[model samples]
Target: MKDKTIDYLLRATWIAVAKMYNEEASKKGSTMATGFALLNIDPEEGTPSTSLGPKMGMEATSLSRTLRSMEDKGLIVRKKNPEDGRSVLIQLTDFGKEMRIFSKQVVLKFDEAVHREINQEDLDTFSRVAQTIMDLINNKKIYKKQIPSK
Candidate 1:
């Protein structure tokens, strides 16, 4: 098979795995961590909206939309940036903080289970392969560069 075909297979596999997790996660929107990396970010540091996109594997527009939705859900609040009136500052609400904690536990168990199945050498190999995949996605902004790119 061609390299592109292989790449497509890999992409399909990733989508399948993600969908499996998301299906499980749908029960508690954000509680099971369907999109944990995107959701659980650094605590409210008075950060700018534009800056968070690249740091969190997001684009400004998508992040804005997500933030707006989360805002409507009372999970976050956005204020006009004092330093730059043109931009918005984001901070999680009390509800979001609590949810972050709960989602983190789910993430931890997921990580532990995946890690437990692999030995050290294979773990290193897996990390390297995953990083390579991420590098490809990051440089290309593949599929919009949302969350870990892996």
Candidate 2:
């Protein structure tokens, strides 16, 4: 399409990337979100249940569902945090550690392929543009009311 909007491009690119990851995850009997969560968890120290949502950019409901699925699959275990009695810590099982390594390799492979395909200058510009967009949104400059009428 001609004159594609920035948001359209961003959304389309994300959807494409998500689809690719989903396909890969399916081969492992898992979802992309599950792989992502696995990657975020600290293999040795474990991660807090409350922090997983923010780390994964997931909603509480979605994170809870994913955590439950992982638990059922024997990929993760939950333990009460000794420091904070009210909080729970999430640790991966031995199987989960193996899966985490696989997930890491997949991510690294993607990065390698992208770097091979895209030149450094272009990648740098893309990174800068993406960061700017995130900053604008984070600062509330992208709010509907804040955007000037075109």
Each prediction's whole-model lDDT (CA): 0.69, 0.93
Off by over 4 Å in 1: 1-5, 31-34, 37-40, 133-150
Model 2 / residue 87 / CA error / Å: 0.4
Cα lDDT of model 2 by residue, 11-59, tens digit = 9999998899889888899889999999999999999999999988999
Residue 35, model 1: lDDT of 49
Please report the candidate that would top TM-score against the real structure.
2
* Residue pairs of candidate 2 with colliding backbone atoms: none
Clashing pairs in 1: none
lDDT of 1 by residue, 1-150 (tens): 465775787789778767766765665674222245335455666467777777676666777777777777777778898999998877777877776666666567767987899888998997899898879777885666458655
